[model samples]
Target: MESQESHRIVVTLAQKARDGADAQQLADFIVSSWQTIEASLSPIIGQRSVATLYKRSFYLASREHPWLMDMHEGMQTTVNLAALKAALLERTSAEIAAGAGAALQMFYEALTNLIGASLTERLMRSVWADLFPVPTQENSA
Candidate 1:
């Protein structure tokens, strides 16, 4: 169960990183992941185990997957996999909890890994093809 959950999280994070075509997809992804964790974990830890859940989840996911990138992710993801893992090891539940803004950071980190240098540029670009201008030779000049 743990292994499977971790795999799903990594996949979800990767998809989110890609800034996929639909915003709802990322919402659904996060919601489903939460549902699974809550269902399997709430019975044992009650309501207060959210942080514990993340800690345990990270531990399980990262143990065998120290490599960071999912199969769908590319070489851009591997650049700082080791460093990120090391940094993640030192994080506290306070710093890295889902509720404490860590989860958002996780998505952002995964996005950075997935896209490398294009992350910032992509953020500045509009998603709609019509809204986004295609630079022409005149514009380049």
Candidate 2:
């Protein structure tokens, strides 16, 4: 439950962190960004409960991996700006939705590059394993 101002701070911190800025400055920026995104998405998700999900998905993901977090923040900002333009250009909801999906796909690509494809895949696998605790193929056999 952070305020919009706090979220902006997180975003600023993330940006600064990417640029090799001071740790304190970067920390403040990230806090602000986290707060802002939370505030903006709160209404759209139709409940405060969604905040936890977003925090885990977006904030936590970024925080745990500094490089990924920086890339994601930058990609999200670009994607959001593009989304605004797409919404304006498209007359139909379908077109707008399509544009948004495209933007998301592009963001995923950016994320992949940020973490490096191999590392990103490994990170995802690890996360999945942490959640599911599935046995390996060799163990199963």
Best by lDDT: 1
User: Least lDDT summed over 10 consecutive residues: which range in candidate 1?
Assistant: 71-80
Per-residue alpha-carbon lDDT of candidate 1 for residues 73-110, written as tens digits (9 for 90 to 100)? 33231122233334434433222222212342343334
- Quote the lDDT for 90 in model 2: 33
lDDT of 2 by residue, 69-127 (tens): 32234332222323233322432333222222232233223334555566534544433
lDDT of each: 0.36, 0.35
Model 1 TM-score is 0.30
Stretches off by above 4 angstroms in model 1 are 1-8, 16-21, 51-141
Clashing pairs in 1: none
